[model samples]
Target: MSEATHTTEILIVGAGPSGLALAVDLARRGARTLVVDRAAALFPGSRGKGMQPRTLEVLDDLGVLDAVRAAGGPAPVGMVWSEGSRQGELRMFDVSEPTEAEPYQGLWLIPQWRTQQILLARLRELGGDVTFDRELTGLAQDADGVTASFATGPEVRARYAVAADGGRSTVRRLLGIGMTGETVDPSPTLVADVRVPALDRDNWHLFPPAGETGFMAICPLPGTEDFQLTANFPDPDTVVDLSPDGIRKAVTARSHLAPEDVTEVRWASDFRPRAALADRFREGRVFLAGDAAHVHSPAGGQGLNTSVQDAYNLGWKLGAVLRGDADEALLDTYEEERRPVAAAMLGLSTRVHRGEERRGRATQQLGLGYRDSALCVDTRDSIPPDALHAGDRAPDGHRGGVRLFDTFRGPHWTLLTVGTAPATDLPPLKNVRPAHIPPYEAYGTGVFLVRPDGYVGWAGETPTGLTDYAAAAGLA
Candidate 1:
């Protein structure tokens, strides 16, 4: 290690989607953040390929949704094949049309690498860049800050730290945190990115289990000529091969294509599906995010989406606390809110892996919220069960010539008036944007205090307790 020392407001211990996403959010908020990765470069594999609608909204707020859309298209329909013959078409997700509230519907297909590249670009645009090949070796946290030592670079000290490292998180281990989980599948699976020019790029080709081999799927990766290949091994003890020749041989044996048809193997790996969650998310000044906090089976395409959301949930709170816009107690909500959601998503992933649930609205994650959280304050009578409430996601709409999402964008809380004006003088708060819209059935009628992350933190028929809520939230 070098004798020099580096300091920042926040230290992030991974450059994957979660870390990069959090860095982007923090950068846009003018927070000094440092993101470091053990690997020499961004991830190269095509793992975690599907981006849900909620994530699209997140990217939109991060100012990278257009790039993400240009990099990928919707997931193609599955086409089963046997003996070089085509079978009927099968839909992967329960499709839905875009609505005023939910503009992004269905799953978008893009490789994990492309998504990370988009995030990194946005981070750079915000004057933040990730440091590569800086492997964390030690961590110690005091009441005031955290110190992280690297193997070959200068040690980093920051007021706060986050572990965006993957499932085998060194930071989590350093903190003595234990994860409780189970293997979702006993069989090992192989996934790879390869180029097969002979295979049509329109449909996701699938093959049923034959003589000895399990199922195989080859899906085209949008915006790229490569295809992602997935194969299953029924025997848990089978040692799968990951080399180019091995991938070509597996492709030839499973599908009608010959070994020569698989011209290139970009990347490959194998894993047994598993679901795990950390015993806790925070320990003193450090917090766990992404796969460091939870691991999913990837069946419902929930792992990456959930991980990104973990960053989204923590980013604003960290920024608010660091900027002195909120009380230090505001940070407690990170774990209070995200743990239950992670636990529920883990169960959903396991069920989807076992064919018990379909990739539908539940997988979209728009309904996930903090309704039962301590931060939620809904002081209204005769509230309908179906009406949007405090802690629910603030819906998007165009009313009174104003678009709700556009007003909610950025790292600021929004005081939104829907079909009602404040009956009393509104309390002044720092970094809080105000907007008023005509009556919209999605939100009914109320004065909602939207959090920086786009959830309604407080709602009421009028601005009765708004001042107290603002002070408690540390925005006074």
Candidate 2:
């Protein structure tokens, strides 16, 4: 049972959305990464079909937003049916239009499989690839790096390892970390992808429950001929059958469609809705991400979005540290900033599952930030409470013949001066691009130092303490 040995800068333990997104980001930044998945291929299902606005922005930064849009569409209106009669349509989400600051205002419907395909394609385009059928059997880390042993292949040595292997993460278990949470719903749910020849693709079809039955929904997946069928079971102890015949029977019992209406069953699974957060996101050189760090119910569409964001937030920090532009201490901020966010989103998901909240602004995730983080340094005086501060997301707009997001794109930090030039001499910072713009209402008049992840790391009225801050952040 001897093992071959390999080495990489970063070893990602799963090839799902989180791992793929992180690989793409790191590859574009000239970091060497090895992504391995225990499964044989990419996921082939329509689960986690809702993509929030913030996630759309992340895709745009990763250079795959156009492809994602082409592969998917907006959420359709839900049509209600009772006793084989059409009832009034019900809106699944509050409608909101795009604005200058916030371009993506609503949820987009893209199958999780399609999203992973786009990310994988982008990763390969950036010179990265994922090795499938490589199951991690054990991992050990010391003061310098981590060594991961696989079940039947070579061992991998990496400076850092991330566990994106989902809720029952093997890496987390090997690290001896515990999760703290509760079951949001004990009832079982059946979700399946099927081809319904007689169903229309214009609207999401909903069927009200009959006596002693639960609600059912059949949503038409965008850009595909398949429909996603979801049915809730009333009994907590009931076993859900996932076979084709079993799914056909469930549809027949819950809706007006007969058993024969379901032409084919492509994929099916069952789960009890639950929410949980890891006790810690980091352990030595190992880190937890995506479902490995937090688990959410599918009600608010927060689980996948939050998972992708976890990768986005960690990617830049890892790139900076690995490229020698920032100190290793930058990695500590990943857990500090993202843990609270995951906690808040976990609560939001549970609330949405229980029907206590609406799918609106909070679901969009535009208001989430890290103003209280240690990396946020705001030296300006008399700032309004509602105004954008350090650690807030930088707004996108055009001013002085430059698009702010365009300037902020890529793997480098940005120094933006609005309505004022530097009052003092600026330091020579590595990988920090500087620009100037006229007074913009979104940013006001200040000197903003934006991080690679598009958050304001430091803000001041002038360049008085900019050099000192840069030195502290390892940019000098």
Stretches of candidate 1 above 4 Å error? 1-3, 422-424
Please give the TM-score that candidate 1 achieves against the real structure: 0.98
How accurate locally, in lDDT, is each candidate? 0.92, 0.91
Candidate whose lDDT is highest: 1
Q: In candidate 2, residue 237 scores what lDDT?
A: 88
lDDT of 1 by residue, 1-476 (tens): 24588989999999999999999999988899999999999999989999999999999998999999999999999999998889889887897899999998999999999999999999999999999999999998888999999899789989999999999999999999999999999999999999999999999999989998888999999999999999999989989999998888788778889999999999999999999999999999999999999998988999899889999999999998988877888889999999999999999999999999999999999989998999999999889888999999988889999999999999889999889875347656888888988889999888999998899999998888889999998888
Instruction: Please give the clash total of every predicted structure, in order.
Output: 0, 0
RMSD of each: 1.3, 1.4
Give the alpha carbon lDDT tens digit for every residue of 1-476 in model 2.
23468989999999889999999999999998999999999989999899999999888888999999999999889999998878989998986888777888888998899999999999999999999999999999988899999997889999999999999899999999999999999999999999998888988999988887788999988988889889999889889999999999899888889899999999999999999999999999988999999998999999899999999999999998998878999999999999999999999999998999989999998888899999989999889988999989999888899999889888888999999985347758888998899999999998999988888999999888888889878788
How big is the positional error of residue 163 in model 1, measured in Å on the Cα after superposition?
0.3
